[model samples]
Target: MQGSGGPRKTLPELLSELDTMLGLAPVKQRVRAMVAEMDIDRKRRAAGMKTAERSRHLVFTGNPGTAKTTVARLLAQIYRELGVVSSGHVVEAQRSDLVAEFLGQTAPKTRAVCESAIGGILFIDEAYTLTEGDYAAEAVAELLTQMENRRDDLVVIVAGYPKEMDEFMEANPGLRSRFANRVEFPDYSNEELAGIFRIMARGQGYELAEDLETALPQRITRIPRGRGFANGRSARQLLEATITRQSGRLATMGDIAPEALNLLVANDLPAPEDSGVQQGDGGARRSLAELMAELDGMIGLAPVKDQVRTLVAETRVDARRRSAGLKVAARSRHLVFTGNPGTAKTTVARLIAQLFRELGVLSSGHLVETSRPDLIGEYIGTTAPKTRAVIEKAIGGVLFIDEAYTLVGDSPSDYGPEAVAELLVQMENRRDDLLVIAAGYPADMDRFLDANSGLRSRFGATVTFPDYSDEELAGIFEIMARSQNYLLSHDLRQALPAAIAGIDRTVGFANGRSARQLLERTIARQAVRLAAPDVDLDALPDEELQTLHVGDLPVA
Candidate 1:
């Protein structure tokens, strides 16, 4: 053999470089494998074999903040070392950079970028944005031709949302075969995201408070449910937001109190603003504590109550373990509350926040509740930022999304799917400080999970809230009656069982929620009866307002 130089630089070297810079090991290993094959091809050419150069095109599909860009950069270095191209630079572009206004401008503009990235990698971020019009279509065609003409000299990586990536491939048949290597960057699991945040936090020289550290993962798991606006990008945004909030709080305090500076206290994270509540003008703003206290006093839901208590205990144990310098094991904090409308999912979510606080998982244990409409935006690019804003507010607390399945729809223009993808990403990234609980009809929820594998993987534990039994409905009715200070007469109590039993058998009845509605209707009927002129108002004491009889109830 000709003078053997020191053993060839292996693929692991490229992976090690990526791991050092970007903290992405899995992606690095993948790119390393690809690079190793390229190196093999290089040696074959050197030995005078007639093997053709293998194409280095890659397809990157994943939610944002999964470190696709970072890995892309490292791959460029590997390619340069393998002598695939002269310059080892990675040129990053998106639809905005390629598409042009004039009729003939698109091709030249696209080619210019390709030419500039010669002998290196050209990364197209959100490459699906090229699907806007015929001009963009032509631009993509030109891009493919460029790739073919310079196959050995260049590498192109196209990336975007998964569905869009599918569409992009379908739109260009030549591209499908050209991109031989496809790498899907899956959304980081809750535990993975927690680890990422911990790394970032530690690297930044911040000592996460013991209680806050313990509570972060549960908070992260609950973030994606109803909020349409968040995903992995939201997690990064949340971290940045926390940093900003912490900086602001620090600024306000003139003298740096040593204790305050040492501890990442409750005030370091900002409180979430309620979207449902109007601001500026005088309006009712209820505290979560008040809501939890009121809900605790309501009767029934023993199973739900017990489960909530257990969750609280687990959180406390985790917190204590963290405080004691013990490693906490990853467990799913996901919950599925399945009662019919008004069976206390919202109320329970509020209580869950307080439970988080008591267990040292949250600072204030506030609840930020949203629905599908809160997340899905009217346009394409707006969804990501809007969803991120909602998560930012819900940080350090519970982000409850009710009727979450509504975010998954059939239409490309629906924007619901976009919201879902974003939510998945954010859930992965913020798996420490945000808790997301999504509630909806059981069937719809299952379908939603099925639609996105990333979601199925992220929401590991789903607690189903079964419909209330007749007895439980009766208890709910009693709770509603007591709330209005109304006492059921002996006759009404006797009739109540029969009425509740009849309701339980009804086709469309929504468990205990329907029972509460019936009780409210009874209260309204009593009001209407009292308004009648025939009633002897003068003879009846004010306590009569608190009394309800069989006459107040309606026949089923």
Candidate 2:
């Protein structure tokens, strides 16, 4: 955009690049049509003929990672070359970029973003989010006014899911008339994804360890495509993940030659189950073995893991006995998880839902996590309806009610009893498909369960989560650092464990959460030391980029 401070390519050269681009035939056709229409309009104006009014604003509807933003940027450059806009820059903004926290702050924020894109295109990503709240409405209104204010020099493009985009346009009359030009970006096929993967790998100077012509495409196709499926982006993620796995695989070796440095292996490719679903069926359940593996992968939950394994075994045996026409024991699928925050209770609950789905106890492995505010209502008689609505949403899945004790407070007008009554009715009615898990502090959760005899009788099992020790916390910190592409130096490593060991872990002390905060703060401290404003970032050494020394660690 704006020629990027370089010699600009001709329009024919740009068109040729589009022609050679993989997939997007429909998009190419639309671009050609727009070019022809604009060219004719120019010629007609020169001949003193009348012309119809047109809007340069557009809407792009598609799933994630289908190159919508890429195409939009190219279109901005083309528009500048064609004199449709004075500058060919693209300013990208999301809801967070426009909407401010307070009521009066949104208009100025939206206007500033719009003004920045005056001589260019303003690209609003996930534009459907503008219809979410009253504040977002203010942003949308401000955007429309700005679009009209700078109509001569600026264009706007809004991108999101097809259905959501349609609804967004219909929800506002101004949006319908202004953003009339719509282009649909189709999801990339397996062949197209493989093409993108190869281009990305080669651009980064990496070569595949396996045959790209056959094995690569097959591997990509086995990953399931759901509603929010990131088509091209998923392929890129796979390639990056494979590279990370390759690095881990090579780390144990003594040393590697220069030749083997950029080679990605077939074994590094993510397996089909790695995508978290079975291909060919959107609702296919995970296998029991796969769920077990997933549960076992968590960092430090020995007791919870053992309980889940035993439950899985018992459920499978019970199913076998039932199939053989023998008397089978019945167990309540509901549960209670008692632990401090960030102790992996919620994570385990999610895993339990997947396990139950694999065990044929539930139709879907979905988990609806909620809190007291989500269940209880504010008004005189609205609590039951609110509670019922939540239960209805969690039907055919696990309903995870976090901080259940908060529902009951020390007030006579409290609606906790009403919400609880409705929840009990739904739990009994939807017993076949719904599984409820009430999770919170150990003592508070016991009180919550004791509040209703029915809830106490139904949730037959409790899985207690133990807080992580300082040693375990250090391991977590190392994992977090590695995931974020940073390495802890020996000095830093030596300091972190001892610092974490001295942390005050009382009632309010979140185990893994505190460790994560420490890790992030350490990274921030690293940036503070190394990320100077006057430094030439491109000239930084690789070791400097990777290493975090003792100074980065906080003094506990």
Candidate 3:
């Protein structure tokens, strides 16, 4: 009756708003198409068509930071412009907001949310979490009943992990029919991730170095080659980490370069370092026998050690045959090192690079370790150059991408896919000189491989890194303490295993790296205690610094 919000200018306004946002073209197109269709249908109905349809509900299944919520907000504006609703407001809710503690309370909570979302879009994020318990199930059912009755007045969108979303739909048969249109938000490909990075960087007024631009994409391509658990979420994490590092460096430099203000330079992204662990130059030239002997002195990596030895042996045989004038085909350039943190994936990568250098497969064999942020650039066209720079740096050596699957995000339109396209080309061309290793959680890696056929073909090896057992974690803690010149008291040693076991029982805290974090925290706490004003360092015995008791460590 209000002439569809001043002649439907909001649809164009929404598109214009998103075009400037960067790395969301696919999503923009989809939204535009939906809005146009809805507008056309509305006009036909007003001109006297018997059937007039309401706004369509959508399901967005993907990880965080893939622009789901951003798109949902824009869709609200489009719906209002198409005469489907009066207000264009977009209300967001998570499981916590909808599900209450007591029985019957959840329904009212969910109803209230829906009522507020009337004449607009209701976006439920992490929607699968709500179906986990009985209270959540009741909330979901009540929400479904409301959707059926208010289909003409509101739009509802449910989003979550792909598998979890399927399960959520299965839990309620009525929901499947109610949410007829499903829009899958695939993870961003590497190119898209790079595009997102470029966008973010530009927004902050930073310029990337030319060399970094060439090398970054190759790094991005190598990200999801083997491991499964990483995806677009990982890409976003890398960006955040890079930004933190850049900000720290900027604070030290006083004023950043005007051109570089929107860019990420190579120096801004440094390879991860290990404290108090030095691998000498001679260590790089060591023979397989010598390398194994050196590795023997390192503690609590038996599984990884065994796998490395086997791989080394096979590479050695191939190298010898090639040197003797026998033509041996080059081995696959892809490797999957599957292990939780602190199992030494980075260390292993460094060792492998050195090994390849010794065998003459690569010229320098230096290792370039990067996550998604390294490849993603901050503008629409800049992603290609930024990703290319990362590949260039890794050209003569090994490129290790941690949590590689982060190259993909929740939507097909995410800029990460573009980065992947660029990466796939470089990987094919640099197969002889470059070795790419991707590591992440198993399931995510599988999904990543499923998304790209070329990635599956290139990655031939898959290595699994299992979490450390409680006993193994205890041994690791003892090793770390000894290296730091600290001795665990008898009681402390006995209590360590129980503490580690308790930590492992907690969700997301069972990794081998968890033990190392605990040990580090304990040392810091002990140092603080020793530095107290009441405890004079000059008066304290040397043994006090050397000794660590159960009280020195935090309780699990």
Candidate 4:
């Protein structure tokens, strides 16, 4: 609901935007019907006649990245403009936000989230999780009760995979009745995805080479739309990875022209494995060489990459020794990753999972990211089972416990200790299958280890991620700019480094974090310049549109 009373895009224009979306023509038609119904209802109210009561609650069933969340945002604004709600804000929630481990906690949490959307929409993503157990059931009850009371002012939209959402609605007696306004989003076809790729690339100021115009669609069509196919999202990710590969390919070449920078040739499209693109998992896993090459392609983290290489080398040697009937110890799958913020710990952790999976160490490479808060419980006796459940969800792959040292609270009766005890038991019990990585500040992590004696032997490999250097910071900023279709002017290359040097590398020198913030600031400034009142969209040429001048840089 931007521009509430001011002149903004009209309802018809907004509807046109919806019409332009890649797939789901049926959803578009339904939305148009919804808008028409709202118009008629408003007319009836104006005529001083009694109007029938209607529920705005909706159930959006779709696969991942089919734009359910995007449409929900648009619907919120349309609801506000049509006088259906007050603010037209949208509050999004996941299962973790609503459900709690202990009794008497979930109602308040779910209620708080609903209160935030008092005059707007409350979107519950993966709402099927609400029917899992008694705790989530209590949350669902709270939600239904709130909706009953605030029928006119509040709108609720629950979304999930089609089958699971169906089961969820059928299992709950009141859910299906309340969410009668349902819409199902269909995944995009290969041709539609190819169109999405072009739109994304042009938005980012890059153009697919002539060969890619044909080859991209073929490759996109070849990819199986199975378990994890995300339609347009898959295409977007492929373009990003391809652009990164292009940058890597050009890094060794000198004197790249500005035109050459925006052109992505067929050579730039990354190989399937190197791009982390899953073509519905082949029976054979990625080779060790392929995984290693992907690791080498990452921008920073020289030390982390070296450590992985060393580990892989040691494991390879041990495999040979065992083949000859010599005694060898099992490779420790647990790790302690310590670093400051923006140090790429999470990214490296995910890559480690993938690398191990490639080498036949784990069944899957999915990284489950959670912290101590996700594992601990409010009540005294409820923490262990909650912690066990968290471990259970991460059986065959990596369980990355970020800021894990937070589990050791300062108070004596803190339930964090109970959670940690349960975690230790699970870590050893499933040591053969699961790989757990505990990550946080170096000192706090060491202290956490000192507190638990058994953890030291299990998590033997400790990898330290160093902060990015000033030059590396500049490189990161450039990469960010290039990825977004902006090429920095020569003056900004020098100006950016000077600005970064003045960023006060003392207490809060967020390395990659500061780089991203800087890039965003520059983009905002560039938009202010390019989008001046006199500029027209039709007249804006590609050259002026893509160039980010030194004036966009912050004053140092």
Candidate 5:
């Protein structure tokens, strides 16, 4: 709170700002209703009438950059004006500040955070993240205790995506019971977003072109809107970028009038491809020849390579058929990659993501990698939402679930099955927009598929990544060493195959990983030998210093 000496905004002024906000009609309406209810309650109290108790704690649901925080800040001030809280200040925190990474620290951390917000609003952004594990559970428990104890003065606002917030409330019975005031913020419409862009430009003392308003909404409509889309913030970011471009354009001109300097035109705004508002073709553009060349250059996985080529060919053929007005049958894009650790399952998955993007099968070539622990939650009612969150992020590209076999379990109480069930639902719901690649050991993956009939049916194609041979391992080691600017001595090159052969072919032995580890160990040993006291470092040539001798190799 500012001191009495500083000027303050009155309740009407705060409400005016809230009402003038571009979008968020429901949010504005709800806020106005709350203010009206509070005002009537105040009058009733003056008339010696009883007032019903209402929960001031709120749950704000929306995507990113929907003015939730802005509204929260305004609501804090409004609460102070209405004598609901002592201070109009807000203390912002996420899971890290409240939840400890280790044991026993979460309660105190959470309590201290709540104590700081005793007289105002405690705004928790991405509150859904707090339902992850036992540590987060401890934070929620302490938060609930603080909310109950400081009911009079503190207003706790939890904000996140609509779906996750619902799951978060259900995760704890106390949370649903306490946070009764739910306000939803929807994504800004094209017209609302254009208005926001214009307001931002005007606020920065820049003038919009006469035609920009009409052109801006069309541009906004073209941008790919995914789960991570920032409705209001995207417009601001574009305005900033456009301002930079406008300045650049002005710099090249011989002379400019002072008034003309701040004027922006449609051409000043970056094209949709160049603006980076979404993953554009500029980043995802890759020739099929280049991708196939890179795949062929990999040390092994011939079968995997063939399978990938077939998938690409099939996608191309399907696209051509569709273009020619032929009805192409719907085919499953999901896949199961079976292999041991370090067999380049992830590497292949990333290549496939890029390939699919290039072929227009996916919107973005991005790859989201997750494991069993990342999807499954420690508590009940947590797994489905967590899995859906992962799927949401991977909508434009690939969801690569590594060691996916671990998602299958015999325990009835286990959350692994819950994650799998959610994956099946999201996989079907978002099939056209999402590519799911599940990778694990062959035997476990077979069992995983058998555990769920939907999994087996959805992932119709399986690509097998075989363990690299001794020769292939040697080739991989040489390529890695050379790529890092290190050369293998003649003697070391001769001993490489023998060293690779000596490695145990036990279950879960990392094939390519072993080769990488060997290279790293050899480099470390080389560094040690070079740093010997007897060695004159300055006298050695660059080649000698970078070479890997047989003595530098770690024993297999």
Candidate 6:
């Protein structure tokens, strides 16, 4: 294969480069198969046998930063080596590159792009965005015409997310016919990601310390695997951040060794809280490890936490299966969260939304909290729209219906059942992007599911949060007090277990809330003692004012 200038590369040499790419086994296999087909066609033509012309157009589907553009560029050169096209360069484009804002300019704009790549490859990034508007549709039509007229000289490759590319292909019959060849690029594994990081660091004259070489992969594993996770690009970003952090650390020291200038240690990696997963919608960046740490820090939800970890594992495996081009059965993402009040049900639901967003299962990951009132209506024929509005608001995230049982009332004429019916339909239609969580007390949740048989099938998993133990309740009190900048005296801490044990765990007891209420009362008592006439306000140190003694403990 001849280049613009320099030593010519052979067909085998071009293929060797493709094989050397890290962590794209499936993509490499598919490209090799395409090459084999091209070789057979060439031999058939040489033997004077007739062969039908095949479409050279290709579709690349996957999340960003999986090397789709990089592969396309190389594939163009391979096409040139096979005598499929005159040149092997690729013209990269997006919706803005092909579509014109004015009504009359779209065709000319689209044609200009295609003409520029007449002897090369036209690579459209996020090609699905063409179906988004009226002007964009005109560009698509022009593109199709050019693809057909220039089929002998030009190859067009469209790339985007898997689900959206499916829609994009369906948008035009011409697209389905022309782009018959498809290849999926999966996110890199943890090991591949670490290797990418090291490669980038070496290019910039930096080396990872021995401890950091081992710790890098572990750190990558903690990052949430999301649709926006730029597999290779993220590795580059992490390397840049690590370098920045190392520079800051070395600045603090009076003297730095020459060898230390280009070395990065484990401590140079960004903290878990700072290295966040960027959401699909470009919302706030939240770290998966930080969210998991928050969930783990909560008191006494061992079983519930385990269930969440299982969900994370499932999502990760499902992603791998899809990337490998395996047929994955469509599974329900909706869940049933059951427990009494103050068992961290709502808190857990919120965290799960953020977690799913980080895992690429959700787009926005924002939680929309609702109940019966938010769904049901006061007048007839109004319930469906109201319920739908709430579901629409939570399309790319989780819809948490607290006290979900309230949606099914005793009255046959009630609108609650109407809301439930609407919910059932919308949940099915939007299950691809939406996750619905029904939460309430254990018994009430059972009643709610039993009321509607459809609910049970949709909510395959149920995580029951048990009431907190007396010891756990004492821990909760301390956590709450400390959060408010108040300290418990040593004796007060010792008395907390006995005090918590005396509280009755009756219906509607609000297990965690009870601890909070006790803390509030103790703080009030401390305030009264501090204001007494015998106490010297000015002489009292700040520490004494912040501390709560045995006298401040609420009576059992």
Output the lDDT of residue 389, model 5. 74
Greater TM-score among 3 and 4 belongs to 4
For candidate 6, the per-residue lDDT at 287 reads: 78
Cα lDDT over the full model 2:
0.79
- Candidate 6, 86-109: lDDT as tens digits: 877778888998888888899999
Candidate 4 local lDDT, 85-160, one digit each (tens): 8877788888998888898999998888888888888989999988887798899999999999888889999998
* Lowest-sum lDDT 10-residue window in model 3: 273-282
Q: Per-residue lDDT tens digits of candidate 1, residues 385-424?
A: 5676566566556778898888888776788887788887
> Which stretches in model 6 have alpha-carbon errors above 4 Å?
1-7, 276-556
Better model by TM-score: candidate 2 vs candidate 5: 5
lDDT of each: 0.70, 0.79, 0.70, 0.80, 0.84, 0.84
Model 5 lowest lDDT segment of ten: 1-10
Residue ranges of candidate 4 with Cα displaced over 4 Å: 1-285
The positional error of residue 242 in candidate 2, measured at the CA in angstroms, is 1.0
lDDT of 5: 0.84
TM-score of each: 0.59, 0.51, 0.49, 0.51, 0.61, 0.58
Q: Candidate 1 or 6, higher TM-score?
A: 1
Model 1, residue 278: distance off in Å is 20
- Superior by TM-score: candidate 3 or candidate 5: 5
Show how many residue pairs clash in every candidate, following the order shown: 18, 0, 60, 0, 0, 0
